[model samples]
Structures are given as structure tokens and as C-alpha cells.
Target: MDRATGTTDPGGGTRMTDRLLGVRRCLAAAPADLLLERLGTELARTYGTTETELLQVDYRLAALVPLSGAEPVIGAGTPAWRCFDHQSEVVQGGALHVPVTMRGDRLGVLRLAPVPDDPERRGELAEVATTLAHELVAVRPGTDRYAVGARTRRLTLAAEMQWELLPGRSRIRPSFSLAGQLEPAYAVRGDSFDWADDGQRVWLSTVNGMGEGVTASMLTCLGTNALRNARRAGLELADQASLADQAIYSYHQGIQHLSALLLELDLQTGVVTAVDAGSPRLLVLRGSEVIEQPLDDQFPLGMFDGTLYQSQRFELSVGDRLFVVSDGVPEAASQTARYGETALHRSVRRTRSMAPLEAVRSLLGDLRAFVGSDLVDDAVVVCLDWTGRV
Candidate 1:
């Protein structure tokens, strides 16, 4: 370990672990606002890549904007955006664009000019991009630069709470890849999503609270935390829902209720245990066929005291994709009619070739286009692919 940098370099050889630690060393001392600058300096020192740039996906999940507050906005279908969307390296016009991602979260891209075509170099650059992503997640809460760079508009207090409450927009694992997002980014309320993977299983939930604004935000917060508290205590699906239901009921005294869908996927077996408490919707796509995964309807959370919840079991094959959405997506209103079943089914099928992260984004984009304007209510969408790979 270097006493100055607080990072270990086992021998002087240029191993990937050593290089990753070196990047961590640079990040360890970097302030939030200077993380990208420090990363650029480290990359230059180590790889002699001086023209590297960090572009972060904005809050709306639309485009990639430079973290350095510079020019050259990268939009969808461009090299940088394609790199981000596809989560791969793209070389165009003598520049290499690499996706900077942490698990399922699509952060942005790292662009390096005049790079070699060597496989080792590609691996190292990809690792460096991933390392930067992990560091950004750690340093994000401490700095405003990340948030500011990603936002094109101010967030309402409700939207702010909803955004902060999310674990991330996407997650990738050996067994599956999951991605989720909420709509009306600037002022979303009442709708939120959460997930956790503990190697053995992944727990996912979508909450839809009553009303709008801060009141709804707070209600959602209370319900989500209650669910979290139960899950963290090692409770099963039914108990987690039951506890959250009680908490909400106690808080609102039956005056308010929130709908939720809680799912637990066994990573090793592909078995799913679910609890459906009122709103939100679930659909499974298997072999080009879209089917709704049915669950017995129960009272919404907080509807009444001592409401018992039951868990239903199902299984997902390796090639299956599951979509869980709040009512906002299916029920979104247009000038003529609702963005209903036919449109929702078509939209989901349209994204069949894309990744989970891109699928959710495309679905929301379709919703926006169908509505022809900003959404009147909050919407949330989560997509999970069961790869079941060892």
C-alpha cells in the first residue's frame, strides 16, 4: 500500500487490480465536484489518455451531458448514447466511447480519443469506466455537482424525495437484470419503486400512494420504509407486506391507502413469490407471448387494520422478461382516450429487442408520445430479465 495514496499496488507490474486500486486512490481524496477531473488526471497519468471526457445521463434519462459543463451534447442514436444504451464500447471517428455503468444503473459514457484496438486496452478501459461508476455512486450523496449536472430542471420537493428514495434505475446480476424508472421526473409524487439483491434472492416493490405532491410523497415514503424495515428484518413476502400495511394503517388511521406489488425472486431456482396489494400491474413476456401474471387481489396497504396478505408462487424461465408497472403507465390519458391495453402491449413488444434499462425508457417514451404531453399523474415502470446463468 502506498502510504500517501492509501492504495496497495502488489509489485510494480501493471495488473488490472493494481490499476483499479490506483483509480480508487485518486477517488479516495477527490471532492465531489472534482471527481471527474481527478479521474481524467489519473487516466492520463496511467494510460496517457489525456482527451478523456465523462458524460452523465441527465435526470430525464434522455441525453448525456458532460460533467465538465462543456459543449457537444450527445443524444440518442449517437455514438455516445449508443454506447450508453447498449452498455458496450463504440469506436467512431477515431474515438472510443465506453459505457460507464454500475450493475444495472446506466450512468453515462467515457470518451477517449485516439485509442488502440488492443483487447487488453479495451478491458482496462472498460474496468476503469466501471470503477468510476462505483465511485460516483459513493460520492454522489456528498456532492451537488452530480445531481446538478444531470438535471435540466428543478425538482419539486415531492419529486426530490421520490428520486432519493430509489436504489438505482437499474441493476444487473448473474441471474437477472432489473431496471426501473418513475415518470413526470420534475414533479413525480405518490409512485416509487425499490429493490434489493442479497445473492440468494432479489426483493422488488412498487408503491402507489393516494393523492399528489408532498402528502403523497410522504405517504409513499412511509410505506416504502416500512416495507424496507420488514425485509431487512428477514421477513418473507407476506410478512413484509403485512408489516407495511399495518404501518400505513396506523399512520393514516384507515383514511389513506396505498397499492403495492412485492416480489421475491430466488436467484438459484428462478421461483418467484409475490404479494399483490391493490394497484400496479404485472406482465410477463415469454417466447414472444405477453401474459399477465395474476395474483389474488387483496386490500391496499393502509386500507384497514390487521389485513392479512398472502404470497403466490410462480417460476420464470431463462428467456422470460417481467414488467411491473404502476397504473400511471397503462392508464395515462390522452386527448382522445387512455393509453390502454393494446398500446401498452404493443409498446412492451416493441422493446423486446432492447435491454431492461432501455426497455423501461422506451415504454415511458411511448407513453409520453401517446399522451402527447406531460403526464398528469406519476408513473413507474420496472423490467426484469431472468437470465438464470450460472
Candidate 2:
């Protein structure tokens, strides 16, 4: 181990690229339970350091729990948390913390103590973290180690279903950035979000189911998957809503229905076509002003069979930000007032200078502070930023 450089090649003269490739190979071969242990060992061998650990963000976003160690859990304001929050590297007390993210999804952070303050070595460490993140995503389905480490508390059955149904907490692309969060994460029911991009257009949806518990989860599942099926079949925005409406109607027979807000963003022109089917609200922040986009209020999904849906088209400026929220957000009430009337607007305005992912997290945190108790219904917020010129 070289104390000054905090780097080494166990093979004596191995190139950094080759070392990274070897790390990838090891990750591919390791089982889920041993995955992080293998990564730590490889990091120590490739870059001399006293400690190497992976800290995964908890489901509630409150803490970073270590994957394999007796180390204390990390919380906000720490270097590891900052690395995860900013999607960048942080160094403090001669230790390095790098984000472990795949695509736009953030899984956690990689921490290396006593790492030298060198940009080249830091970048290489980032590459190693990225490779580990990709491997974790690929192997997560076969085991529960990562999932178990991500949870600070047990999830309700409905919450588990909703979490599984999510595409991801955030996604980054050339044309746009999108992120979302659900309130009362441990026991959330009914509220869910989905999005897909097929190069030309990005489709986004938010569903607020009618009931609670597993019933609400199933209701949302039906509507969201129906929309996905339609979108995958190459249906446009309105028809996608129509198909989901028909599916929900068939399942509930007018007795149960879910409110949804659907959007399709044209990657080339920055035009957004939307179907506002229920109580969900869409707000746009252009420059410093935040304005609620008023769309024609159509019938909620499953309200009746063959509910003809219409598309409303609007253009987003290159720097515009969009917020799509389920009814749970506006309807969130304290003893004195509803969050929608004033607090929601204020919170949205406060997030104007934030990135899409951080904005979503901040807004949800504000909601939690205002409510100050377990949410009776699920609350969801999705934030999107249009960069144009894809």
C-alpha cells in the first residue's frame, strides 16, 4: 500500500483500465450477498486505502446504510450523503466519497478512506462505482441484499408493490431530466408514477387510486400497466389514456376509478401534449414565475366506459420546469389549512433554482414538514426539466 498516492496495482504494472475491467469481471461473478465485499476487496487491491464501503440510501431517503460492515449508518450533511445528493465526489479528512449511479438512477455512494486527492484517481474510482452500480441493477432481481439494505424499516405490502412498480426515482437524458418521490413511503398506497422514452417522445403519468392498502395498489397497477401496454403498442397520448380508461372500467365497472395526469413531451420541438383526467395538477416554472397549467378537466379513468379523451398541446421553452402532482399533494391538510392553497405553491417556487431530482426531494420534504404526521393517502410529485435539442 502506498500511503502518499493511496493507489497500487497488485499485479505490479497493471493499467487502470485493465484493473477496472477486472473489477467488472469480479462483480459479474460474485453473488448478491458477496457483491459489496468483493467490490471492497478489489478497491483495496487496486487503490491502496484502509477502508472501502458502499452506503445505500434508505427507502425513506433518511439514512445511508452500509451494505457490509459494522460502520455506523450515515445521514444528511455527511460527505457520503453529499456525494449521493449531488451526484458527485466529495473529499473530507483525506477520504473520498463518490456517487454510485446508473443512468439517472441513484443507488448510493462508494466511500474510500485515506484516498489521495488526485483527480485522475478520483475519476477512476467513479468508474469503479458506476460499474458496481450497473452490476447491482443486473443482479438485484435474484437476491434481496440490496433491497434489504435500502430499507430502514419494514414496508407495508402496498408500499412494496408501489415501489416495485416505479420506473426509478430519477432519470437523466440529453433532452430532459425527470425525477419523482412518494410520500409516506413506508405505508404509501395507491399513488404511483411511470415514464418511458422511445427516442422521439417521453411519456409521463401519475396515478392516484381510489382506495387504500393492497386494493389501491392493485387499482393503480391495473391503470399504469394498461397505459404502459398502450404506449408500448405505439399509441399516442390520448389513445393511451383511452386504453387505460377502458381497462380500469372493465375491472371496476364504474364502481372504482383512478385519477391520472398523462403527458407526452416531443423531444425535437419541446411541445408537451397532455391529458388532464382528474385531480392531478401540472405546474410550469418558466423563469422565476410558477404557473399552474390549466387543462380541460376530463373524466377520471374508469368513470365510464369509452370516455373520449382529448389532448391539449403546449410548448415548453428550453429552460422550463414542470411539476406533476397527484391530488394527495394539494389535498394534504393540517389542522389549519390545505397545503394546496398556499404551501404547495410556495414550495414549488422555492425549488426553482434546484435540479429536477433535488427539487422533487425538497418539495416532498416540505410536504412532510407541513403535514407532520403519517399521510392518510399517498402523495406523489414528479419534476421535469426541458433542455431541448435532443
Evaluated with TM-score, which candidate comes out highest? 2
As a TM-score, model 1 comes out at 0.92
Which ten residues in a row are the worst by lDDT in model 2?
Answer: 1-10
Quote each prediction's TM-score. 0.92, 0.94
lDDT of 2 by residue, 114-230 (tens): 786657767888998898888888888889888987887899999999999999888998888999988788999999999988777889999898887999999999999999999
Alpha-carbon local distance difference test for all models: 0.86, 0.85
How many clashes in each candidate? 3, 0
